[model samples]
Target: MNLPHDDKTCGWYAALPPPQPARRLSGSQRADYAVIGAGFAGLAAARRLAEHEPDARIVLVDAQRVGEGASGRNSGFVIDLPHKFALENPDAQFKQRLLRLNRTAIAQLQSLVDEHGIACQWSHAGKYQGAVGERGLAYLAHFEKLMAALGEPFHAVEGRELAKVLGTTHYSRAVFTSGCYLMQPAALVRGLARSLPENVELLENSAIQRVERDGLGGYVLHGADGQIHTPRLLLGTSIFTREFGYLHNRLLPVMTFASWTAPLNAAQCKRYSGTFDWGLTPADHAGTTVRMTQDRRIIIRNTYKHVPKYGRSVDDSTRESIRAEHRKAFLARFPDLADVPFTHTWGGVYAISRNFTNFFGQLEDGVFASACDNGVGAAWGTISGTLLADRAVGATSSLLDDIHAVTGMPSLNPPEPFLGIGVRTRIRLAAWNSRAEV
Candidate 1:
């Protein structure tokens, strides 16, 4: 099995204060239930399991620090609606089901932040989808029509009004929807880990190297320095789950890069005219995502690469090239801040399926998994993980049924060299088609 090897350069994690020392696993340990991967899904799964079986010992393990993985590296948009393009599902009932599930996930997160007083810059400021070129504008119009068909509320901003809202004349048009939330993702995930129930034990920096059957209907997980024995196991490892001998060619791992500027001084802030805290996603799927954080830093995220070997193939040259792309995007959007320097640049991998559906069910007897959030991991990943725990414990509800109804198994992907060629060609075409938006 391949171990996680993410670079410790995430801007979100870098912004927070230092964390307490991590507790590494050694020798051997036993647990009633063990979950591999401590991202949003794994954290929720372990917490839910502890709730259902208070007397049972539950273990959660991660290859790195909890907040430094993909969960914390996301763009931090907790969307309450389906993707604008995803509405083409042609099944209004299916869209509504997804909406309910996403909202439930947001509500659960809100409750946790309130109960724990976690200072993650949680804001209901909503989100904006912006367009720069005529092609992007056309796509934005279709999205507006879809929103109207669903009876969802949105406000259109354009001309000087749009410039005032985004502090950039680069965007020609935009639509603001009031159903999303934004936050510091690393802080949120770390807070979630700290507030877990007493019965659940979290071990960080402990990568599971291999998995094998114990001949007694149980599994043994081998780590660098120790091993774990559990009768039942749940995996929330996303694309990394393939290392455990599952999901073979059914998943595609794409790498995305992001960079953030240092906090603007008073003079620079005076020149900037937009709201202090705002996030804007591009109307085109291949364009960049921009955000003006509460702390006065600007962020630009763009560029995608298909990395089948996880991120192990992302070398220094690849990182430098991506950073250059980020710089160009930033200057195009905010030329006035040309003198501002970026404090950090990093890349993270997200998994997607060929058919754009998540995997959520038992892979085998006493083994279950939830993965492939397809880029909406913030909310979708949370609910999927929570419900997965319920399914493992023999619990059922309408929500669980809704999940099973909307989600389908990932379809098979083409064999190796062919898959690599096809994915790279598709990514290049997307970037070229949306060049103006970038």
Candidate 2:
């Protein structure tokens, strides 16, 4: 199924000055390594490959602009081993394995930000998963123990301590980790792309139309303007998995929408935000994640699968209803902001797999793949990219075992046959509840 493109975006990164226009492929060319999709995963692979083979000719191709996809559209939260994992009881044998890799991903990302000196407003203020009710608090309280038993570091903060960390009396309990960070998503992507070695080429507004093996070890990637032949190809395209046939079927493309409030002043900031953590994402599904930028714009995002549209073109009635619900949620969380106008509203498609885990491995000879971030792309994307690059360049990593454990099948690309019905039912129920609340 061809999903429509939804291109609406607003964030600090979107506000940055545009970089020099990238040259779309003009003629058939070859690179030592070719990366498709210039988002976090692709960029990570390209950057890692450059590190391993400094002189290797590397080329990155994106259909749109850099960071224009899920990477740029995300809330810019760098979280490791997110709650999605909690939903799935991954085998105990490799629980630590995933956590270690996640920690590594976060550290490596920060290292890159520092080494390249990319001024993307990166910070390591950590995060808080506050519980809104007894169930949420109970889950969070147990999560702390589970993470501890798994040898992962986590702290449970509650009461005044929770209030201190979250700067809100609304939170009765919370989990605080000093490891996560918030960033300007598009800025970081652009910054990283800019910091790449001059030898690496980036082609923007260039979409990969076809991929065929060259009969040799190399593969030919056909783009609109031109083509590329490379010995090694990394597939970093997520969400738009149909472009790669099999990869698409193994993934779930879910649409997540976010809205941004006009920048809040000092009084509003005191009333809305407290500490510099990335954002206050509820431990349970209250259907909202709240973030305040350095400039004090409040961003609230929610994931709901509807008629998939990559670009934010919705009917006037639907848009108005969404806006109203978003506002209502914001006010419930922060009553002081009830009257505040939201200056920007937009949404994007982020990919996830049926099992809710990122699938990464080689797809075909000389072609590797890594995607399905499941809404935690910042850290996982980095890890997947680095691992793929390492595998390509023949580097050793203990993560290979866990990587092999994630089996990919041809059936993953399309939504399950009954998924549309399930999704529609959930939407209707949510709408009914919202109306009943009135």
Which candidate should be chosen as best, given lDDT against the real structure?
1
Per-model root-mean-square deviation over C-alphas = 1.0, 3.2
Per-residue error (Å), model 2, residue 239: 2.4
Q: What is the lDDT of residue 77 in candidate 1?
A: 86
lDDT of 2 at 269: 68
lDDT of each: 0.90, 0.72
Segments of candidate 1 deviating more than 4 angstroms: none
* lDDT, model 1: 0.90
Residue runs of model 2 more than 4 Å from their true location after superposition: 1-4, 86-90, 159-167, 270-273, 276-278, 306-309, 312-319, 405-417, 426-438
Model 2 TM-score is 0.88
Best by TM-score: 1
